[model samples]
Target: MMRRLCWLVMILAWSTWGAAAVEREAQRPAALSVYQDLGGTLNVEQVAALPEAVFRELPERRFFHEYSHSAFWLRLQMSAEQREAHRHWLSVGDPRLSDIQVYVPDGNGWQRMQAGAAHPPESWPVVARQPLFRLQATEQVVLIRVVGDSLLVVEPLLRSDGELLAQRRAIAVADGLTLGIVLLVVPLSLVIGFIMRSSLLAAHAAAVLSYILLVCVVNGYLVHWPMLVPWTSYIRAFASLVGFVCFLGYLRVLLQVARLPSLWARLYDGVLAAYLASALWVVFVDHVQGRFLTEWVMRLAAYGLLPLTLLTAWRRGLPLVWMAWAVPLLYLLQFLARYVFQADHLPWQARQESYSISSTLPGVALLTCTLMTELYRSRARQRWAQQERSQRRLEARGRLEAAVARRTEQLRTSLDARGALLARLGQELRGPLLDIIGSARRLVAMSSSDYPQRIERNARSQLELIEDLAALSHRDELPGPSLRAGSLHAFWREMVEEAELLAARQNNRFQWRLGGNVPCEVMADFGHLRRILLNLLGNAAKFTREGSITLGLDCLERDGQRVRLRFSVEDTGIGIHPDDRVRLGQPFVRGRNVEWIDGFGLGLDIVRQLLEGMNSVLHLADDDRPGSRFSFEVCLMLAGVQDVASVEAGA
Candidate 1:
């Protein structure tokens, strides 16, 4: 009976122990947060030697994070059973990390193993994008210390050899596709860039090349391509920023941002400058700071404003609006993937297997697609336009020949076949010639108080005007710019006298509003300056009839010795219609407002060419009063009284 009781009690005790152990096993979590961050200051040896009490538990070890110029100590504990029987491999998700120091508990101390981009490639146990480390089976703690430039989101992965191999195969396939696409794009981008022969395409290629290098560096491909190792940080940061700038460039061309408000254009410029500054900082000063600057600030400015800019353009009925919205949408998705969910924290295996998408690779892929689409459409349109232009040219030539034949016939009839010179003059000065013929006939038939003298003087003036026109038509140049010290007061006074005669012929009001501060003399090409004023004033007089014509000269910029003078001619006559504004300066193109006016349509075009020779440009203004207002500036050296006296004596 005593032996039986002992046996039963032993059985009961064994059953109780088994049940308690089962309950404990069931309560333990399958996945544990084994790693702890003892912060940045602790070195591997010191950390390894520290007791468990000094470490705090990292409750959410799964949430990997990024920090600037920071170090982290991570510890993973293994049980005796795990150490004795099973071999484990550790995986790092980000290849951009500069340093990863792993320590294994050996006897009473720690054994340090270095593996990361900072170390040589051959030293690594496994040749992979995400560096893999083989952990020696031990019953003690494993600790890893890490740091990098764009070092973000390191979540240590522990797997069996089989699992690691499987992951390697999977990642190899994923990277093959991603990297393959990137490599493919390089040549295609180059070919497209050459074919397009556009700066936007060149800019796109630059952005793409930067992106390619960035991806290669991120994937630890630099382990093979050692030549690029020195530029990893610069390439990655440059990729993001340049991609943004190029996107803006595309926006500028496609949306024609210059047509947008000046404020909007200035905003684009500011963002571009900001990105360039950040890129420079990354290349020369602080890589970490630049990385964050581009990722957070530059990206926000670019992506946020890009969509709005595109949307505004679309609303204004610009082409490529679909792409404008599409590209931004892709970027928005990427932004959420990177910032909100922190998809970068996902395991490399998961990311490669498409359980999650990385931000950079996919974003670049989308951007490239959109760019190519836009370029393709543009090329197609250009080709179509060329064909249309050719067709129009052929048609225009035929019509021009017909019109010239008809004009020649009309002039021959009007002149009654009176030799070649008279017929030529008839077509050259058709409107003025008709008036001259009528006046001559009237003088012969009727007597007036002073008609004969007036007619003779008018004929002489007309002959002089024809001579001037002939000089302008001599295509060599406006007599090469003879820059010299000349008096503005004298030049304007003489020009005003001629302008009055011109204004008197049409009974138009001529007003000279010279500023009191106008310089007496300045350095300029007197011939060209005089011609410029003549053209502006002449155009004002021709376009105005029984209306006011104003000639104005003023100082725009003044220094002690140098001054910039602005000459303007404003008229109250037939104003230039908005539709004809763009056509005004083209050769042989006439403004609708000047249809009844007598001109060969070469005045404004000749004026533009003349101003260009003198390093100036013709600026047209919105005629708030009535007619067209034309203005231009000339940089002249102010001349003293002695220089004027010498010039007058020489003349």
Candidate 2:
């Protein structure tokens, strides 16, 4: 009897322990699994009809498929205790999912609940940051249908209302802090960039703002706002595309890519353009294809081009280029672990909130540090530039002062030279005036024919001197000669008469020679021609005493209506000295050997000025004869007989 009682007591105790263990197990949340509907045609009835074996148990608490067109069906089997609690809620953690339909068992029917970006929060069965469905007391199974246009990540959880509220409160505080920091940092960066006028800073700020916006979209912060709900579908794609583009721009500026080789700069620009096109494609075209292309392009830029450019910049001696590798390296590790290696079991992958914060915060910090370092370098460069500019200004001031002093000295020397020239000119004029006065007094006392001629010659010399002075003073404003057709023979006869008078004063024999080919009627400026020849013949006559002077004309060439003629004057007088050649053709300047001659040195200067106006040159030839030979060539238009008649008739 004692053995039987011991056996029964042990059985009852073992049964009680097993029942308590069963009760504890019943209170725990149900295990969730997923079914991929490749055709996306499965309804709740069809999914329910399918065998449980067709569904695969999800290995991680949260499942991630970057982007997919296929629909996913999630099945959750609730424990008896969870069903009886009447407070358990089934939550789909991603708010950006395009469509989420939860079918909760109610009595014999299924209570369908809709929530997600597609449905407004007001119509949701239970409004929250993400989709939520209240579990019925008698519910045993919950079916969730999910469809997404962007990155598809689903984390389904079964928890009581109190637990969910507590978890959300914690998330809200963390999100608030993150958003506050973003708001503070974004505007601060912009203000600083504007103040400094730094493109690098502005690009960095743009990148930060865009990336934070992407994070907000991914983490479902924007979808909760009523105004933002309409854009929830496309916001993720837009943010991602814009973020990558902005990041590339930031890198381009940071690496000083414009300063790089043309090939590298072009490559960076192509990548930037591709990213921008992708962004526009997402907004205006098909979002799914756009996002797919964007991902591929972003990967190419971030993984291939970006790293190579960084390496190139580092090799090319860009300062702090190595520091820019931190963000990319961090991103590479995160990408490899999350996507390539399928490290979804990690603690960070439990919630996108944590994952986004973890992935982005470090990159933001690294980029910020790199930018700050660049900012310091930029400030240093500005300082160096300022110092260089100041030094250049001082050098320019010194040069300007020296130039001003040199110009002042030059003006002073010119003024002194002009004063001496004026004194000499006055002395020359006084001698001529005194000669005229003495000749006039002699004519008045004796009434001799020689006194009249002597007085007339002195008066002519004074008049010539005054005329030369006037021509020199108005040399800059002189008009070119007016050309007209006239008889060359008649013109020369008049000129010869004047030349004979000049030659007679010095007892010099004057001879004239004209070429046989010389045209009778030719276009010529008569006034200028007369002045030029008379000056040459008079100079010859003055310099020669009882010496023969010859005036010669030759027709060099004739082409149709134009005739090229050369004129020459030769005198048997003192020739030009070698030392005086360089100093000739200057106003108020006389040859050293000609100081004893009674004349001012304005003849050659006037001849040069007049010839320049006529597009001709005065030439002094080396001669075997005792005197100088002056020659010049001019082209004249041949005129008809009627033209000469008209000219004579007009005269």
Question: In candidate 1, what are the lDDT values of residues 303-386, reduced to their tens digit?
Answer: 687778777877877655455566667668667776687786543323332212233355445546645675777889899999
TM-score of 1: 0.49
TM-score of every model versus the real structure: 0.49, 0.53
Tell me the spans in candidate 2 whose CA falls farther than 4 Å from its real position. 1-28, 59-61, 84-86, 272-290, 314-358, 389-651
Give candidate 1 regions above 4 Å deviation.
1-39, 49-63, 79-85, 120-128, 198-205, 226-231, 238-241, 261-265, 279-290, 311-321, 332-383, 386-651
The whole-model lDDT of each prediction reads 0.66, 0.74
lDDT of 1 at 464: 44
Error of 2 at 203 (Å): 0.6
For lDDT, the strongest prediction is 2
Residue 176 CA displacement from its true place in model 2, Å: 1.4
lDDT score at residue 384, model 1, on the 0-100 scale: 99
Superposed Cα deviation of residue 639, candidate 2 (Å): 99
